[model samples]
Target: MRYGCFLSEPQGPDAIAGLRDQIAQAVADGFTSAWLSNIFGLDAITALTAAGVQAPPIELGTAVVPTYPRHPAVLAQQAMTANAALGGRFALGIGLSHKMVIENMFGYSFERPGRHMKEYLDILIPASRGEQVDYQGETLKANVRLTAPGAGFPVLVAALGPRMLKLAGTVADGTVLWMTGPKTVAEHVAPTITAAAAEAGRQAPRIVCALPISVTDDPAATVERANEIFKIYGQLPSYRAMLDREGAAGPGDVAIVGDEDTVLARLEELKRAGVTDFVGSVFANRERTRSLLIGAAKG
Candidate 1:
């Protein structure tokens, strides 16, 4: 399994510079990849561009940037620039964010998100490949051509539901999943996504699972921290349904919290379930982070 770390774009004094330092530290710590979360803080593309200049050889990616926030053409432009700045080591992970985040936070209409994403990809893929896109859909319409030749960055969709997974298999390079447990990944996500890819005559689609992990002696305290950090997801209907189907009562149940051996065992369980990549969201301690990354790299 490939090991990575998620850098939160914390908003405060010198946030962008702090992000650059964090990315540099993660790369120095032997992380294969460093991912930036797309949210209200620093724009992921800009932050990554700065970090790309300071960091060497570490792959950079967005955990996800929501499709609702911008048109595909716009995203394609930004992604191409960032990828170029990073010397072609940026992965663009796009998704339809939750209704509350889109509508309530960003003030966008959250109607028919699955359909919107399908249409969005239709434009995004072509544009990211530096082709002209003249497309119209219920939610978005675009007519633009990329200025650069092409970034050719791999695109991963943040997919969960059946239809979206099928779309990712058919069109995208892979899927990026969060908060999904091993059982659901094995029984529901892996088979369906790979089957769809096979039906489309494509190679097996990549399954990148982002699981919150912490190597802590105090497992209960670590679980509590996970619960607090991911509490908002439980209230979101889509994520709630996903967790329910996985037999996870809450974020605490899904978090990987234990000693080094236990955490490695859980990660092995995920790999056995067909996860191609593991993006570790380390939240317990800096020492634990170093231990997990070293262990994962050696493994």
Candidate 2:
């Protein structure tokens, strides 16, 4: 499995410069890829593109950018443009987000998220490849072709459920997961997506799993910190289902925590479970965890 690092939001005055520094560090540390989340802070693709231009080339991707707010065609155009700017090192990861955020916060209909995503892909995939689109589905409509140059970057979906997993496998390049454990990925995630891809006659899909991790002497204290810091994920419907599938009481239960050897063993288990890429979110003991991840990548 390819080892990646989750680029946490940068602090201090110049956030963009800080992000660029982080990317440089990732390259220096010998990581295969680096990811950024897009919830409330910076625009993930734009920020990464800007940062990536300054740093040595390393694969950059959005863990997820919400699809409810942007039109698929526009997003495809933007992503392709960013990819071209970054010398084709960008991957676009999109998701439906949560029902509450879609309806209550963004004032968009969350009635048919699965259908929305399916239709969104109908427009996005072709448009990103510089093909003409004339789709009119139940949830979305697109009738334009993008003028942006096709960089041929992979598109991933933040898919957790069956419908989304099937869509990801059949249509997109892969699925990007968060708050999911190894058991769930082995039994439910990998099998479901791989079957769909096989049925569609597509190449093996990439399953990128991201999880909070810490290399600490005090595992119990780290678990407690994770439970408190990541409490919200346990309440989200999609993540909650994955946690339940893994029989995890909360996000902390699924977090990879322990000494270097233990954490490495857990990562190996994830690789055996068919994870193509692993992104570590160093929640605590940042230096120790990062050193272990870099060593894992190198070793």
Per model, state how many residue pairs clash.
Answer: 0, 0
The number of the candidate with the highest lDDT is 2
In order of appearance, the predictions have TM-scores of 0.95, 0.98
Q: Name the weakest run of 10 consecutive residues (lDDT summed) in model 2.
A: 144-153
lDDT of model 1 at position 72: 89
Pairs in steric clash, model 2: none
List per-prediction Cα lDDT, in the order shown.
0.85, 0.93
Write model 1 residue lDDT over 174-234, tens digit each, in one string.
9998889999889988998898999999999889999888888999898889999899887
Candidate 2 residue-wise lDDT, 1-299, digit = tens? 99999998886679999999999999999999999999888999889988899999999999899998999989998999999999889999899899989999999999878889999999999999988899999878999988887447899999999999999999999999999999999999999999999999999999999999999999999999999999999998989999999999999999999998899999999999999999999999998999999999997
Give every collision pair in model 1. none
